[model samples]
Target: MGLLSGVLGNASEIEPGKAQADFAQLLIQGERVEKAYQLIRDSFVFTDKRLILTDVQGMTGSKTEYHSIPYRAITHFSIETSGTFDLDAELKIFITGGTHIAKRFNKKLSIYELQTVLATYVLR
Candidate 1:
């Protein structure tokens, strides 16, 4: 990801293999990362079984929180593509119990591909 994009709070797509390795301890047997996105200090990892959100906290970045949301718990989702003036794409995911998560991706990442990945698991 470009430094400017990170400074602007826009996320970038990351290698799935790297995410898979970094999160191997949290995965159940047979679960694998299919896609991953990186922010400045956090990351979102999509796996065959669930979505993993890594939140790096504190000034020292020593504390971290991992949140997992299963595909079956995702009630619905929406994707907004980048427009002529709007340079960022956005994704909103609604969970089973009124939880909402929104993420913005820079123009460099394909929002359609992210939607496809979610649909493959959520719609199954």
Candidate 2:
């Protein structure tokens, strides 16, 4: 991701291997990370079994919170592709019990590919 995008607070893809390693302890026995995106210090990870969101807190960044949502809990999702004027793509995921998660991806990330990934799990 470009510095401009980062400055704008848009997310960019994090390497799968790195994400896997960083969130290893949070994964269950058979779960594996499929993809991950990072916005500043925090990350939202896509795993085979669920979605995991990480929020880094405190000035030292020691405090952290993790939210795990199973694919079965996802009610629906939507992806908005980047336009000529809108350089960022948007993704919105609605879960059971009225929870919503939204993220914006910079031009470096392919939102269609993200849609496919979500479809693979959520549609199953």
TM-score of each: 0.97, 0.95
Question: 10-108 in candidate 2: lDDT tens per residue?
Answer: 998988899888898999888788989988888899999999999999999999999999999999999998899998899999999998999999977
C-alpha lDDT of all candidate models, in order: 0.94, 0.91
> For model 1, where is the 10-residue window of minimal lDDT?
12-21
Best by TM-score: 1
- Residue 23's lDDT within candidate 1 is 89
**Best of the candidates, lDDT:** 1
Clashes (N, CA, C under 3 Å) per candidate: 0, 0
